[model samples]
Each structure stands twice: as C-alpha cells, then as structure tokens.
Target chain A: MKISFPYMGTSHIVVSYLFEKLGFEVIYPPTPSKRTLSLGVQYAPEFACLPFKIVLGTYLEVVEKGAEILITSGGCGPCRAGYYGELHKRILHDLGYPVEMIVIEPPLVEPLDFLRKLHKIVKPKGIFNLLHYGRIALEKLKALDVVESTLHELRPLALDKQQINQAYIEGLELIRQADSVKEVIEAKKAALEMLESVPADHTFKPLRIGLIGEIYVVLEPAANHDIERLLGERGAYVHRSIFLANWTRDNVLAHGEKDIRAMAIPYLNQMVGGHGQNSVGEVVRYAEEGFDGVIQLAPFTCIPEIVAKSIMPAVSRDKNIPVMTLFLDEQTGQAGIETRIEAFLDLLWQKRKKQEAS
Target chain B: MQAYLGVDVGSVSTNLVVIDDDGNVLVDLYLRTQGQPIQAVQEGMKQVEEAIKGKKIEICGVGTTGSARTLSGVIVGADTVKNEITAHAVAASHLVPDVQTVLEIGGQDSKIIILRDGIVVDFAMNTVCAAGTGSFLDHQAARLNIPIEDFGGLALQSEASVRIAGRCSVFAESDMIHKQQMGHPTPDIIAGLCDALVRNYLNNVGKGKEILAPVVFQGGVAANVGIRAAFEKALGLKIIVPDYFKVMGAIGAALLAKATVKEKGETNFRGFVVSDLEYQASSFECQGCPNLCEIVNISVDDKVLARWGGRCGKWDTLSKTG
Candidate 1:
C-alpha cells in the first residue's frame, strides 16, 4: 500500500525513512504549497485551527497522488488537534477519496493502548519489528534535532545565512541516507563541519531568544512564516523548547526524564489542555536559563495557546524577560510579523546594552 | 546646523521631522499617504526643504519608521530603519519624559507600549483588526457629513452616553446605522462610537499592559480630542497628548537616526534631492518552491532597488547584487 502523512519541517525526512524501512511505499506529502492552504481553507470549517487545515490539505494532495493509506497522530482536547483526525477523515471521505486511515493516539493513562493501536496498523510486521525500527527512528530524530539546533545556534552568528541554510539542507540529506546509528552520528558531525565552515561574528555576543508555543506551529516553518530563520538573520540565537524526538518521547513514550510540567507549578498549577501548561513552564524555564527574550507563537483561534497568552504577561513581569506573542493563520501578513519581531529584537538589544553599562 | 531627518510612512499619513543637535524640532510636515507612500514621502521631503528655506540645515542622519519603513528607508536612504512601536516609544519617552505607557492608534491598527524608565518593556499590537483604528472613526465621520477634525467637538456635545457595538467594524457600522435609525442624537452616536473604540482598544491592544501614570496618547488619531477624552474617561486618568502627536513616529525615528549615526560615525542619508527620483513598487509570486512567497520588488526608475517578502533571503541578495 502507498503510505502518506503530513509535513512538519525536517521530521518528514525521518518519517519517510521510517515507513520505508517498514516495507511500505511511502509518498511523502509534498512541502505545504500555497495551494495547500487555499484548498484547506475552502474545505475546512471557518475558525478551525491552521495546522488542521494544512494537514487536511496535505492529505487531499497525497490522496490525489494515488496514495491509499494515510497515517497521522491524534491529540487530546482543549487543543483542536483532538478533533482534527475525525474531521479530516470526514472531509476526505466527503471529498470522494476512499482512503484507509491509521491514527495513533498516545493514551494519557495506559501506554499499552498506544502499542495496541500501532500493532493493529502493522499486524503483519509484529511488535518486535515495530520496536526495532522505532528505536532507529528515535536515534535519527535525535541526530536531526542536534543538527537543526546547531544550525539555529550558528545561523545567527554566521556572516552569511545562506551558507548555514545550504549546509543544513546537505546535512539533513546525509542523515536521511544513513542506515545505522554510527552513520547517523557521523552524518551529524559532517553536518556540524558544514555549518561551522561559515564565518561567525566572534565579537558579537548573539542575543538568545527562547521559542515557546504549540508544537505544530512551532515546528513547521511554513506555518509561522519561518520565524526561526528570520530571528537568526536578525542577530538572535533561537532556543526552542520543542524538538521532534523530545516531543515523541515525552508525549508518546511517557519519557518522564525532564518534568517540564513541574516548572509550571508556581504559575499554572493545573493543565489547561494541549500545550497550554507546557508553554507556561517553558517561559519559566527559559527565564531561568538566562534567555534575553521569549516569543510565543500560536495558531490563530487556538484555545490552549490563547489561555497561555493571557497569562504570559505575568510570567514576563515575574521573570523580567521581555515576551512577544504572535498569532498566526493564513491571513497573517508578513510585514506585521516583521515589524513585531524587529521591535522585540531592538528591545532586547537595548536591555542588553543597559545591563552592560550598569 | 547639523540636524537629523526622520520619516514615518504609515498607511494613512506620511510625516517628517527634522531635529537639531539639541533635539529641537526645526521642521515638521504631515501629508496623507492616500495609498501611495512613495509620492507622500517625496512631497513631505520637498515641504521640509522649503520649510527650512536657506537656513543651512545639514542633515547628519536619516531614519525611517512605520508600516512602510523599508520602502521609505530605501527611497530616502535612511541610516536606520525601525518599526513603529520602537519609534513611537522613543518619541513618547522623549516628549513626556516620565511616560509609562504609549497608546498609539494608527489608520489600520492600534498598539500599546509599556515602558519602564526609558526602555520599552512590553508591547502589544492589534492583529488584522480595524475596529480600534483611525479609519473607523474617519469612515463614521464621512457618513455623518462632518469633517474628521470636528469629530471630537461633536462627540463632546452629546448629553447622554450611547452604547454602540465596536467589537468588529462591520458590526459597529451596522450598529451605528441602527442607533441612528433609533433617533439617537448624532453627537451621542459619535460619542458612543468613540467610547466603543476606546473599549475595544483597551480590551485588545492594551490588554494585560501595566498602563501607569503619564500615559502618552499619540499618532494621527490623537488629533481627535474626543478619543483623547474617551481614553481619559475610560482610564480615569488624564491622557497626555503631546504637541507633535501626529509626527511622534517621525520624531522618534529622527532620534534613532542620531543615535545610529553617533555609533557608526557616518550617515547613509542620500540627501534632500532624493525627492526628485522616480520610484516604483511591484510584487510577484516566487515560484522557486512549494512556498510561493509573493516577493515585493521596489525599483528606482528601471533599476531594481530592493526585493523582499520571500521566506528565503536569496531574493534579498538578488536585489543587493543588481
């Protein structure tokens, strides 16, 4: 069967590799094109979150490309992601596409439910093979995250953004081609070399800006107008709170290593659903980490993020780190975002200069 | 006489401010953008030149601000190009020395700037909303057959406070018409509109902001005393409207220009004669990849000056090379 899934930055590389290793003919959903948004918007319910429409559009696109199976993850409520799977299914069915769907919703209470769901989708392959490939996939995710974080860290300090961008592209390709964990590690080192080859501004201490928000909007560059790269070019180091590996581990595997939720105790005592609780904790963590500023990006009309945004001012006040909130949707104009980001950077720069003077 | 020039090219107004080394305003000019920022900038520049006459005004640096900052900066050859929030904050702090908050209502949107000491600590802007902006008032004024200048006085003449829906301009417009049909006095309706707008601004742009005493209200909308009064009544504190409220953005830009020039020890000011140059702005959808960014291309005569709006910076490099 031809398999397909929606795109989320570099996660596509790892996903495409994963399914292919599982002996499935995977047709990766093409990078979210302009048409993807328009088509999605036309079919989607008005006021539905952005990530939902984009994913719906990508599914229709891949379905039209002769893909018979669609695999996507599902989320619990308060965020629109919980409803996305069923609604997207109905949308495709009404659009006249007869497609089989596999939705892997990680159970909040019982982890075995997640495994059972995965096993149901791949009954022929068995649990052992799934576990084996999953381990490799996780390794690949770690390597990709490292390379991406490095690219973000260095892109701001580098003299030429293009040089770093090109290196990152090549670096991802190498990781995608690697078959073993050692090869993935070697691929990461090669990528690091490519990134470090670019000349860096040694004298300038780059401003560090923490990126905290909903996972889909934060991870997908196209969704938020490529804010990370924009921040890098504007002379700020981006320290994101979410990565593919970490997210997969935290949410799906229940990897309880870093209790990010514990950081939210003083401010947000209870989970408000989705990533609302996480966003609160992230800002607190970022403040403690000595970040110069924090930017909260959320899809327009997103419930959880809206809750977090209302409480953000208090966090900014208590932590003494300037925070800027940007809500994104299809209608978000580039110039407006540019102005806000530029203004935020200027505030950080002035704050840094003042602290140094004092 | 070494002076710095600042140009604020907003959606509705194009303002210019020329300040001497001592920060005294030597010349100020305000003109309507009227859908063409280039023409407005050129006209404003010429007016500044004429206003100075033979006063030997040597421009030491140039700064540009507002929504069309990049376009204006390219056209005017600015030493520093900054956003309106920073420009407004800087200008307000300079004018009202101990200013704690700045409430700026422009043509298309409104913003709130919270400042501690002299630096902007927090700020919020209305997103793609025109309910709490100057254009909303301007539209209602035109419909009422009154000049925009007399809007404040008319609003003040009302005996009773009428309630008009100002959550969305579409709803507000219909609600306004409904209020008029209900035989509410024109002044009362206008006053209601002002109150509604203030409520909208405070709820949206000014949400969660620490608006301390000495709040400075500026921008083109500040010309209307009714909105200022509405701001005062709502906040229960007198709002300070500076003398150069309309051109505060330009003034702030000029201050930034001086600071930038001092640090760099040079100026990129293309000179006053740039008013005579032919400029054109156009855009095309880049087809390089899946993300078809509609890149904005600015040109001087036939030569391409700058290209932007792309997700990738490659198009920006093309403009630099050309």
Candidate 2:
C-alpha cells in the first residue's frame, strides 16, 4: 500500500521510516503552503480550525500522488479534535477520494482492540518484531527533539541565524536518512557539532520567552508563521512546551501527567479537552521558572485554547508574568503579527530594565 | 536648528512631525492616506517643507511608525522603525508624564495600553474585528449624510439616549437604519452609536486590562468628542486628550529618532529631496516554491530599493541586509 500522513513539524521523519520499514511505499505530501490552505478552505466547513484545514489539504495532495492509505491519530475529549478522523473520512468520501483511513486511538482507552488492529496492520513475524522497530523509531524521534531544541537555543546567540537554520535543516535530513539506532545517535552528535561550528556571542543573555498552546499550531511552522524563528531572530530564547517526543511520552506512555495536572489544579481544575490543561500548567511552570514572558498561540475558534485563554489573565496576574494570546487564522497577516511581536519584545525589555534597576 | 523627523503612514492618515532638540514640535502635518501611502507620504513631506519654510531646521534623524512603517522607513531613510503600540505609549507618557492607560482608536484598529511608572505593564489590541474603529464611524457618518467633522458635535446635541448593537459593523449599520426608521432623531442615533462604539472598545480591547487613572485618549478618533464623552461616562474617570492627539504616533517616532541620534552621534536621513524622488511600487508572485508568495518591490529609476511579502525570507533578507 502507498501510505501517507499529514505533516506536523518533523514527526514525519519517524512516521515515514516506520511505514517504509513495514513494507509500504511512502508517498510524502508536499509542504503545506498557500495553495494547500486555499484548497482546504474551499472544501472544508467554514468554522474548522486551522490544523484541520491544513491536514485535509495535505491528504488531498497525497491522494493526488496515488496514496492508498492515510494514517491519523484520534482522541476522546470535549474538544472537536476527537471527531476529526470521522469527519475527515466523511469529507474525503464525499469528495470522491475514497482513500482508506486508519485511526490509532489511545491504547489506554481500549488496549485489546488497539492491539488487534495493530496486529492486522503490522502483519509481521510477531509482536516483538513490531516492538523492536517501534523502539528504534522512538530513538530517532528523541534525537530529532534534541536537535530542534538545541537549534532553538543557539539560533538567537549565533552571529548568522541563517547558518544555524541551515545546520538544523541538514541535521533533520541526516536523521531522516539514518537507518539504525547507532546511526541516529551519530547523526544527533553530528548535528550538535554543526550548530557548535556557528560563531556565537555567549556573553549576551537574551530574553526568555516560553511558547504554550495548541500542539499543531505550536509545532507547525507554516501555521504559526515560523514564530519560533521569528522570536529567536528578535533576540529571545525560545522554549516551547510541546514536542512530538514529549507528547508521545505523556499521551501514549502515560507518564508525567501527574505533575502537570497538579500544577493546573489551582487555576483549571479539570481538563477542558485538547491541551487546555497543558497550556495552563505550562504557563504556571514557565512563570515559576522565571521566564520573561509567555505567548499562547491558538487557532481561531479553537474551543480548548479559547478556554485556556479566558483563564490566562488570572494566572498572569497572580504569577506576575506577562502573557499574550494570538489567535491565528487565514486572515492573519505577517505585518500585523510582526508588529505585535516587536511591541511584545519592547515590553519584555522594559520589564527587564526595571528589574535590573530595582 | 537641529530637528528630528517622524513619519507615521497609517491606514487612514499619514502624519509627519518635526521636533526640535528639546522635543518641541516645530511643524506637524496630517494628510489622508486614501489607499495610496506613497503619494500620501510624499504630499505630507511637501506640506511639511512648506509649513517650515524659511526656518533654519536640519533633520538630524528620522523615524517611522504605524502599519506602513517599513515602506515609509525605506522611503525616508529612517534611523529607527518601531511599531505603533510602542510609539503610542511613548508619546502618551512623554506628553502626560503620568499616563497610566492609553486608549487609542485608529482607522482600522483599537488598542488599550496600560503603563506603570513610565513603563508598559500590559496591553491589548482588538483582534480580527473592526467594529469600534474610526473607519466604521466614518462610514456611518457618510451614510447619515452628516460630515465626519460635525459628528461629535451633533451627538453632543442629543437630548434623549438610545442603544445600538456594536458587536459587528454590519449589524451596527442595520441597527442604525432600523432606529432611523423607528422615528428616533439623528442626534439620538448618533449618540447611541458613540455609546455603542465605546462599549465595544471596553468589552473587546479593554477586557481583562486594569484601566487606572490618568488615562490618555489619542489617535484620529480622539477628535470625536462624542466618543470621548462616552469613554468618560463608561469608565467614570476623566480622560485627557493631548494637544497633538492625532499626531502622537509621529511625535513618538520623532522622540525615538532624537534619542537614537544622540546615542549614535549621526543620522541616516536622505534629506528633503527624497520627497520629490519618483518611486515605483510593483508586485509579482514568486514561483520558487509551493508557496506562491506575492513579493512586492519598491524601486526608484528601476533600481529595486526593497522587496517583501514573501513566506521565505530569501527576498526579505536580501532587501534588508544585502
């Protein structure tokens, strides 16, 4: 089968490797762009969140490339994301694409059924064989996370940000081409060395800005207008709360929920659905870490993020940290976003100056 | 006299201010942008030249602000380019000295900036909504056949109060027409509109923001006394309107330029001759990648001065650093 998946940052690197190893021809969708967004908007419902539209556009592009199977994840929450798989299937069927969709629901919800579906899809020698490959794939994911986090840290400090960005892209490609666990580690080491080769100013301490919000918008550069790079270029150390590896560790392996839930209890007592509690908890954590500011990015009309945004003011006031929420949509312009970012950096710089003086 | 120049090319108005070394305004000019920022800026420059005619003033530094800051910065060879929010806050604090809040309603946007001890603490701008902005009021004034200049005075003449929805501009217009058909006087309706706009501003942009005392109201909309009265009534605090309310952004830019020149000991100003220079602005779609970005180019005598509006930074970086 020619298999495909929607792009979410570099998650595709591991996913394509896994599928290709499973004896399927992987057909990668083109990078999401203005054409993809416009196509998705033309076919999608008026109020669908940005990620949904973009994912739909990705699937459409893959279908044009003769992709036969589409893989997507599913969730059970109050947020509309839970119904994405079903809605995508219906929309695709209505549009006459007729591609097969496999939704991997959370195993904690229905382990037996999930294993049974996995068995049929894997069709391998045994479950142990699948586990071995899965472990290798996860190692690659970890390596990618490290490379990206390192890039975020070094980008602002480097004399040539373009050189840092180039190294990061080359690093991603190197990891994607590696086959074994040892190769992944070697690629990671090589990538870090590449970043280290860039000339940097180590004496300067840049403003610390934490990113907290919806996972798709936070991870996808195309959706958020390359906000991580924009902040880094503006001389701020960018720290994001969500990455594919950490997301998998929390949502799949089911580890590290206790700490976040405990932090969120003071403000958001319960989960309001997709990543709402995570956002609140991340803000509190960033505040405790003494970061200069937090920026919450969410798609327009996203319910979970909207709920999180409503409760952010109290947290910001109580923590004595400034928080800004930017609701992005197709109508968002680069000029407007850049202006807001410039103003926000000025605010942070002023706060830092006041702190130093007192 | 050594002076600094600040240009704010906004959506509706292009304002320019020339300030002396001591921050005293030497000359100011405001011209309607009218969907042509280049011509508006050139016209404003010409008028400023005429306004300061025979004065021994040399522009020591230049700055630009507002939505079209980048374009204007390139045209005027600005030493500093800043966003409108910072520019407004700087100007407000400079003028009022103790301004704790700034309520700025401009052509297509509204913002509330909170400051404490001469530093910005918090701020919020209206998102994806043009309901309570100056352009909406301008449109309504034209529809009602009342000149925009007399809008505030006519509203102040109302003897009775009415309510109109201000959640969306389209809904607000239909509601106004309904009230007009229901026999409510024009003054009453206008007063109701002023209240509605104020209400929208407070509920939307001012949400979750602490509006302290010593609030300064400025922007093009500050001239609307009806909106000012509505703000005073809503917040239950007296609002201070600065003498250079409409040109506050420009003043702030000039102040920043003055500061920059003092630190750098020189300026990048291209002089007043740039006002008469012929420049051509054009755009083309880039086919370099899947994102068919519409790249814009501004040229003088077919030599590209700047290019922007691309998703990839190839053109943008080339324009800025190359």
Candidate 3:
C-alpha cells in the first residue's frame, strides 16, 4: 500500500519509518517551499489559517506522486486543527481527488476514535501483530525525539552550516536504518557523537536569540526556511521554545498539575489558554536568563502569537531585551528573513558592546 | 494623586485610558486609528490631558498595547509596552475576577481566550477570516442600509432564522442575497447572519478545546446584543459584557503600566503636550537584498520615533534602545 503524510516537522521522519517497516511505500511531502505555500493558498479557502494552507499543499503534491492513503493528526478543541482533516477531505473530494484520510485524534479523550481511524488505514493481522508494530513506532518516535533534542542544542554550536546539516542528514539516515528499539537508541547515540565531533571556533561572542512562536513554524525547518541554520552560521545560538520534549511536558503532563484556583484570577491571571501561556512563560524565562534578544515567530493571523507579541514588550522591558516579531506567511522570502536576522544580530551585538563598555 | 496613561493603537481604533493608583479609570478617549498610529496617540493623549486638566492627576506611568504598541510606546515614553492579549487578560481579570473565557471580537480581528486559574492556558485568534469579525458585520449592516448600533435589535426581532453561509465575506454576501431573494424577512435574515457568524466562529476560530462558562465577550462587537444572544444560544451559556468593553485593551494596558510603575518607583510618561507634535511615516523598499521588504519609518519633527517592517530587523534594531 502507498501511504502519505503532510509535512509536520520531525514527526514525518518517524511516521515514514513506521510505514516503511510495515512494507508500505511512504511518500512524505516535499520540504515546504514558496511553491508549497502558493499551491496551498491556491487550493485552500483564502481565509483558512496558514497551517491548513500548507497541509493542503502537501497533500496535493503527494497525491500527484501516486499516494493513496493519507494520515494526519486530529484535534478536539477550539483550535481549527481538529477539524482540518474533515475540511481538507471535503475540499479534496470536491476538487475530484478521491482518497482516504486517517486522522489520529488525541488519545486522551478519543482513543476509540483513533483506533477506528487506525484500523481503517492499517488492518493488522491480529492484536499481537498490531501491538508489535505499535511498539516499534513508539520506540522509533522516542529515538527521533532524543536525536532532535540533541541536535537542537548542537546545531547552534556547529562551526559552519555544512557540518550541522551533515550531522542532521547522518542522524536521519541512522534513524531510518535502525531495525529495533536497541538499534534506535544506538542510532541516537551515534548521531550525538557525530554532532559533538564538529570543530568549534569559540572566538566570536555568540548572539543568543530566544525563538518564540507557533509550534509547527518553530520546529519545522521547511516552514521557517532553516532559520536556525542561517542564524547559527552567522555565529548566533538559537534557543527555540518549541520542542517535542517541551510539548509533551507542558501539554500532556502539566495538565493535572495546574492550579485550578487560578481560574478565579480574571484575564491576565486566567489561562487564556493555547500556546500563548507557554510562549509568555518561555519569553519571560528567556529574558530573565539574559538572552541577547528574542524573535517571535508565528503564522500570519495566528491569534496566540498575536497575544504574545503584545506582551513581549513588557517582557523586553522587564528583562531589558529587544524582541522582533516575524509574521510568516507563504510570501515570507529568504532574503527578507536573512536581512532582518542580520540587522537583529547587529543590534544585539551593539547592545552587548554597549553593556561591556559601561 | 498619581495616575497612569494607557494607549492602545489597533488597526481599527486608538484608545487612551487614564487610571488612578487604585485602578480606577478617570479619563478615557476612543478614536479611529485612521491609518496613522502616531497621530492617533497624539490626538488621544490631547483629549486625555483635557479630561484630567482640573484634577491633581500626575501622569505617573504610561503603558501601550495593541498592534501599534511599540511605536506608541516610543512616542509616549511608555514605561511598559505589552501585547493586547496580556493587557486585555490583565484588565479583564481585574474587572471580572473569575473570567474563564474571553471572546474578543473587534473591527478586524477576533480572539478566543481560555483562562484557567487566572493564567492564559489556550487562546486562538482570527485575523485572516472576516466572517466572525466586527468589520464583516459592519459591511453587512451597511449593505442592508441599517445602522450598526441597531443591527442587534433588528436581529432579536427575527422570527425565523435563515441560514447564511458564513464561510467568508464573499460567500456570506452571496448567501444573504440568496436568502433575500427567497423572500425572507430582513430581521430573520439578519439573525441568520448572526447565527452564521457564530457558527463560523465556533467552527473556525473557536475550534477544538474546552470553552468553560463565565465567558466575557468584549471588544467593539460585544455591544452587539444579537451576536451575544447568538453566542448564548449556540453555547447555551450566559456571556458577560464588561462595562468598558470597547476599550478593554487600553484599560488592561493602563493597569499593567500601573503595576510596572509601582514596581519601578517612577514613571516615564511624556506630558500631554506631545499631542501637538508633527508625526509622519515614510516607507522605502530596502535595496539590501531581493526580499525588497518595504521598511516603515516613523518620525516626529524629523527625529525617528521607530523603524519597523523590514524582515531582517535592520530598521527595528536601529530603533532599539540599549
């Protein structure tokens, strides 16, 4: 069977491996490009969120390459993400593209919904066989997360762009070749070693930039146009707020630990929920920790980030930091981003120099 | 007595609110933003100064928020500049101590904020789509030759609800036309439009997540009783409309400034005479690269107040105070 998936940062890498292990041809959407966004905007409803536009673009591209089955995450909240699958399916069907969509809803509230969706896509031989593949997928996902986390730290420290990218390519290759959970762990270790061995020139004072914004845009290199690589190559250490570990920690585990009494605190005190809370906490933390500057990234029209943008000035003043808000749309060009980054870095450098002189 | 100044410069409106030390609002002014934020702030500040002229209101601190917060902050010498979310959340919390959800629909944007235990847990905003936003409703009201203020009352008088496709402004207009051609009453069609708007909001902007009670609907749209009624019927819960609904963002910003000023032991608010300063904005496409980002520079009496919009932070960085 031929299976397809949208580009969802590092998650796609693991999902592809799982499908490949099950003897299916897995077609991952090409890395996001201007063309991808244009295609998405062309096919998608003009008013739909940017993420939806990107996803639609990915599916259209993959379907053209002969992928029959599509898989995507499902949501159950005010976030339009939950309904994207249904909407996308309707849109595609209306456009004369017939295919099956398998949505994996969150396991917390809708385990049976996920199982039903999963069963429709992959009819495992039996319970044991299904459990076996699930175990493999879980292990691969964990390994991928570990490697990605380590790389997030290492990418900022690499001497040049080539070295960091080489390490990522090797790491992904190692992950793809691993056959067992033990092998996955070994691959992660090997990837870490490769990254650690890159020569480092610790001469220039690295500009520390805290990246805060939407999860998908922050983690996805394709979405942000390899912003970390561009910044890292220019002697800056990128402190990204979104990561698999952080997402799991904040969203999954922190739910029960929240002080329910805080519900009484009115607006600012209340959780005006979504990624805004996490972003506020992260930006505040980054400022407190003395990051040279902060970059707020968000898809154009993203509400939570808009809130974050409003609050960042207070964050900037409290911590004496500078924050630049970048709204990413399909029209975000590389040269535009590079110029902005260079100027931001220069500002940070000047600010640091001023501090040192004083 | 010490007072703080708060300015919120949004795409649609610019608001100025003055609050005393105990968080009591003393002076407030709301003006259309009208394409120029610096001018709006200057004008708004003039009104505020006039309103508090006789009182012993010393401008102890200034805070700015909304889309143009940074520029407004620089122009006014604001001690604190925050986003609309933080300012709104803070102000809303102060007003309604137990606000769990905040549904803010303004002229150009709509936001759904989920609050848990007083911290913003999850929030969604709508900037791309116009269906659920106030501007969309304003357009519809204009097309129907009805004053926007009376739109809600007319909708309430709707006996039969007609379903208008509220997917986008284009679709909504066509659907409304179709409903009108079907001989539907104006009130019923208006109510249906409101219902369609609420449905679109719930389906698109207010998608997945928990929407608890004690929901406060603010911003300019909160004044629309029909939309509020639609929300109540759709969600089956009572929605609270704060007293200063239209200017909540500005109020929240003032409250934040108060807190910041108290902590810092001083205020950096420029005097109200700043309203007369000549302000201008000019843009230039940077020849630095192919990106061709049109950098916007704001100046007052030839002194650069702020520079922004170039993608690479070139201009913004120059405006930064180290």
lDDT scores in order? 0.87, 0.89, 0.75
Cα displacement (Å) at residue B201, model 2: 1.6
* Candidate whose DockQ is highest: 1
- Please tell me which predicted candidate would have the highest lDDT against the true structure: 2
Between candidates 2 and 3, name the one with more favorable DockQ: 2
Better of 1 and 2 by lDDT: 2
Backbone N/Cα/C clashes per model: 0, 0, 45
Per-residue C-alpha lDDT of model 2 across residues B29-68, encoded as one tens digit per residue: 8889999999988888888888888888888999999999
Please provide, for model 2 over A199-300, each residue's C-alpha lDDT reduced to its tens digit, 9 standing for 90 to 100.
Answer: 999988999999989888999988998899989988999999988897887765543566876898999999898889889999999999999999999998
Per-residue accuracy of model 1 over A1-358 as CA lDDT, tens digit each? 7989888878988888878877788997988877988889899998898898888889988998988888887774456787788888888988899888777776654567676767665675666776777777888999999999998889888998887888889999999998877888899899889998999986878999999888888999879888999899989999988898888877766634246778887888877777888888999999999999999999888888888899988998998988898998887478898999998998899899999999
Model 1, total clashes: 0
Interface Cα RMSD for all candidates?
Answer: 1.2, 1.2, 11.6
- TM-score, per-candidate, Cα-based: 0.97, 0.97, 0.57
- Cα deviation of B131, candidate 3, in Å: 1.9
> Which portions of model 1 miss their true places by more than 4 Å?
A107-113, A124-128, A255-258, B319-321
DockQ of each: 0.74, 0.70, 0.03
Candidate 2 lDDT at A23 equals 73
Candidate 3 lDDT tens digits, A178-240: 877788788888987887788765465678888877777787766676788777767777877
